[model samples]
Target: MEKKELVMNCTLALHGCRTSYDRSDLDSWYLLGTYEYDGSKLYLNTLDDKICYCDRYDATPLKSWDSLSAMLTSEIERIFGLFDADGHCIDEDVPTTPVVI
Candidate 1:
């Protein structure tokens, strides 16, 4: 895809998150990270950089932003349940930004 289109898609895929793209050579844009959402499953690169889809529950790989978002929301809910109503996670430790490629 074109750089502009790829940037736009990444932006949409990473809603509520921040991202940065590298275009050092003008011929390519590199998304820096091991985690990526490719409009399908959330992929994690192994130590050797082999792409692997995240399937936490042994269910089908996540196939859309909605599914990923729901999973995150559920996790947040579970974490919140562990604390009192007014408790909040540490700001710096929480992942407020996500990467999409």
Candidate 2:
């Protein structure tokens, strides 16, 4: 008989297409991903020339969520962000949460 071992690497990411405000750019894709425990990340639309930019912080510890679902659910909000009633962004100094503002 022979001995064998299995190795598993769990990783997940979500992507979607969004149209740019400028008429020349048209549409582009954005990303949000990797397992929460595996250091989840958010790549959003940039303000300047770059299409996308990384929104992760070294000091913040928003990764390592309880489960895969929780990670996905929370990270999605980084795209929408904490919007106010008047459609403005609400900034909070919470490390565990995303801050698009």
Candidate 3:
């Protein structure tokens, strides 16, 4: 649950919500958090675990849903590693300890 002071003033249209599937129940959806994406400005919102939200953020109308989704997809692609023609991830090595990139 989110703290009262960190209440999210974000809307679903402009903010992308990240969800998770419980290890025990794959069919169920649980919210992880919200991401406020404004083009180059993307930040983890202070939203609590819920599937829906109001249409306004801080008394301002949120951006289109398309913008939020597009940003989320782009960010995921950048973070997720690429795969090879053989259908395996290009980088297969596992790190035993922390190493700075």
Cα lDDT listed for each candidate: 0.33, 0.38, 0.31
Q: Which residue runs does candidate 2 get wrong by more than 4 Å?
A: 1-13, 16-62, 75-81, 92-101
Q: What is the per-residue lDDT of model 1 for residues 1-101, given as tens digits with 9 covering 90 to 100?
A: 55434433332232323243332333221122222222333332222232223332332333323344454554345434433433432343433233223
Better of 1 and 3 by lDDT: 1
lDDT sort, best first: 2, 1, 3
* TM-score leaderboard ranking: 2, 1, 3
Model 3, range 14-41, lDDT digits (tens) per residue?
3344354334433232232343332122
RMSD of each: 14.2, 16.7, 16.6
* The best candidate in terms of TM-score: 2
- Candidate with best lDDT: 2
What lDDT score goes with residue 63 in model 2? 29
How does residue 5 of candidate 3 score in lDDT? 17
Model 1 poorest ten-residue lDDT run: 27-36
User: TM-score for every candidate vs. truth?
Assistant: 0.24, 0.26, 0.23
